[model samples]
Target: MRKHRRIIAAFLLTAVAVGAVNTPAAASPAIDRGALLAQHPLTTYESGAEVGSALTAAGFHTPSSRYGVSLHQLVYRTVDAHGRPTAASGLLVLPRTGDRHLRTVSFGHGTSVYRGDAPSVAPDDMFLSGPAITFASTGFAAVAPDYLGLGAGAGPHPWMDVPTETSASLDLLRAARTFVARQGRTLDREVYAAGFSQGASAALGLARALQGGADPWFRPAAVAPISGAYAMRRVEIPAVFTPEVTPKLGAAYMAYLLSSYDRLHDIYRDPRDVFAAGYTGMGELFDASHPGPEVIAGVPDSVGELLTPRGRELLLHPNARFAAALREADSVCEWQPAVPVRLYVSPGDEQAVTGNATACRSSFAARGARVPAVDVGVDRSFSGMVHEGAELLAVPRIAEWFSALAGSH
Candidate 1:
């Protein structure tokens, strides 16, 4: 265990050194979209065995690995939630292969409250880096965007904001393409989009953007989002008040969502207007710098204790800007996509209910699109809870599905 800890420390040190040495100079007058600001070498797996061992250590299922993997932390330029220019960071994992042209997988990550837990910032975090590493080790270039305000990005994260998630993710793909080009390698135009939980919604949004020609070079080939809260207003919000969601978990999610939405949509004039007197300063805990556990501990167990009655009513029956924001965020599946999509879910998931995936599929069908919701089943043995266990099982399936699609095409 001591040796393992030393190896991780070495990787972190190497990343810091590389980033310090390769940091880009000051930006010019014009902002370059998708510009690679800095690249840091994180770690490398020399063989499939090493990749499997790493996955096992990270508490994720071991997928069939093909090539070794090289992971890097990439700081790139992207627009913030408000459409202002900003810098964001993410993980770029490349497979060690002889092929000059590589297929790409863009993974949207689950919700992260603390900046330190981001994939680029904490590559050893299984939940953050597992999907990206899995895809890369299986021979695809994996790009996992940390989204705005998380990782090395500036400002508080606009959590659950689909537009920023889509923008950040698309920009990372652009940055990855640019980085790979310099190494005599090129990315395939077809991109396989996948994400877990909050990232699952992001993956759907990104696929929509890619289909809508968000980028000139890359296009989404297939989308597979696992355990995502796709229907926020209808399914997700209502579930928060039910027995399905524990009070503590629901309170934390509501706190993060309300605080983030307030930043983008001006949902509340004052913290007191939304939060209960005892929890008036709850929003401040979600400033991205606070540790997630600390933030959770600071808030009350139940949403009722966390919010004012008006605030609770507003969430239950939202109106005005808050309602509009929910509509926008919930509209991820409103548009029809030209590419195939599969929504993965676990029926036992307490946080993001399985209803979300079903609701998303219904929305897609309403738009004359056929999308399937696949159940990854529940893992009783895994201690990360049903939500995370769902992701653990779903990633390998997503990789296999993506590989098959690539093979067919």
Candidate 2:
């Protein structure tokens, strides 16, 4: 982390609504709701070498063959979870060299506790920028949305809110196209999506939304999401109590998820209802300003200790309303993906609880949508094998997978 700098991203809620504005249901027009508020040049990497250096600093390696590229931070208009008009900021990495028939790859970034990890804010952050460079430097137009609450957006981030996550991503795709066109460049109109960790779930949701005709013009070509917690109620939620998993990480995730969920649904009237008195200040952690480790340190040794007895019971055997929210967030792979889709996983991954990939594959298969759950072999320590290792090793492989799909499109 480069001294966490708050870059005062210019956020403006413009007049344009993201989807079709006041259009008839039958007349599904493609609408670009993400209005560009401001654009700032972040940096221009002269070649793959420069991109690699940045990636290394962010704890990763870049793709072997790279192209000179320019990165820009964009503040644009999009709606929030409530469908109210809001603003978001993200990054657009444009390759200086490549085919004139440029296509766009919408990358959903992985988990980051601090708001500073946002692609637009920390352009060199590996989680976002490394993948951005990997895709863009390989001759594709890469766009990484900071999501609704992260980056320059206001309020607490919805860590895994499926609908808003999908909408924000879709809006960014629209924004990217609008921005690219202004530069006298035309895109192939095909959008491919990939993500890791939390982003994997977002990518899956985005794929479902796009396939269901969220955007009439940008059809999905292929989607690959790596090491994601797709099954929350069945696997992810319960795993917090298991000793093998990192209790601190689980506690941090629960704090983020539950606090954000409370805002969307009135599940709890007070923090004490869902969290123990020991976890009084957990709400402050989700302001999107704190770092992951610091947030984790604030949590109890186990998530169970942080939750009230009633809260634990409710979460473990969630009531109708609570369960519904969990189901909605976990329903990433429920819909079929018309395009080629793959769920990359590490069988050895300790971060993600068991059954996430299995459940996703099963859901897709039950719908007669045969999607592969590819296992990316683990070659790192179990600590590394948790999440970051899976991301570091799997991103380039996913990029290669996307490249192979190019000819089919």
Candidate 3:
């Protein structure tokens, strides 16, 4: 029996090393309740055409051949076998230079807003260039999804709510595979996910969905969660509400809640504070105050500029519960990984409490994940904090780390 436990542990460690979680011996509730993984509704190239229409509306279009390489851009939609509305839209961002073993990295993009401001655009939106293009430039078949709502239809971006988002995510990849297969092109399951900020939330959601649920193709080659949020309990929105939290922090929190729980508009400190008074939209209000980019100059002081009196009152509600669900929603450790797991978080990050990474590390450690929690360059002036502090330094380190671990396999 002791030898058997050691074998199970060894297999789990191997799986974690590869970023996959082995399914449990017994059936789990998440699988029993949510939409299980299945095939996409579309099978042929002609049927996959409508996805282009969705892409055009989202301000993304296939690249006209430039400088020798060609790129394809389109929005894709499909209903899973379970009938959940799963959709994906992203850029193929490159012209095939050669027949390289086109590696694919389906980025789990950061969090997004409902409809107000510009930044609220889905994280996968090309306008927000960060990770999608970076990986594409490095020779990976990068795929990004607008999730279910940010670019899909309406209501509930889910905020790491798991079930729906994971379903949409897994199916999006399945859809991509189907699209590629129809074109007579092939790509490796070298398929991986690098989730940052809110994208980390999406990554974990998809990871849990693939861990042991009834499918095999859903497995990711490796997963790296940078400044990952493990459970909603660590997501403290009230911390952002305090005066010391800064305008950017408060604005992000209020805007997120406004979208996540729109029905509670009446309870806001000032409805206009979050969204414009006449505003009925679901995304953030991208204004002079809500600028793009994480640069210090871009952080706004006017997050509260659009507030209505009632909005302020609602925001001030001390008993708010948004933070609770965000942290409590995920369990990266409970579900073991089949591939290696890597976690990156700055020791000095002001946005996410230090404990967030600690929790994720704890879970990974328990499940036998070969976790190496690296600093985001916050403490290393030698590593350089300047602008990338966490975001910049973390990206390449992620590439290097994954390379070293995968070589072992």
Say which candidate scores most in lDDT.
Answer: 1
Deviation from native of the Cα of residue 318 in model 2, angstroms: 1.4
Error of 3 at 38 (Å): 20
Supply the global lDDT for candidate 1.
Answer: 0.83
Q: Estimate each model's TM-score.
A: 0.93, 0.89, 0.61
Return the TM-score for candidate 2, rounded to 2 decimals: 0.89
lDDT of 1 by residue, 235-311 (tens): 98889888887778898899888988888888888888889887877667888777766777788888878888888
Candidate 3, position 356, lDDT: 69
Q: After superposition, how far is residue 220 of candidate 2 from its true place, in Å?
A: 0.5
lDDT on C-alpha atoms for all candidate structures: 0.83, 0.75, 0.47
Q: What clash pairs does model 2 have?
A: 18-33
lDDT, candidate 2, equals: 0.75
Residue by residue across 326-391, what tens digits does model 2's lDDT show?
A: 999788888877788988887656667547889888988888899888877664542344566676
Q: List the candidates ranked by TM-score, beginning with the highest.
A: 1, 2, 3
Each candidate's number of clashing pairs is 0, 1, 52
Model 1: residue 188 alpha-carbon error in angstroms = 0.8
Which candidate do you rate higher for TM-score, 1 or 2?
A: 1
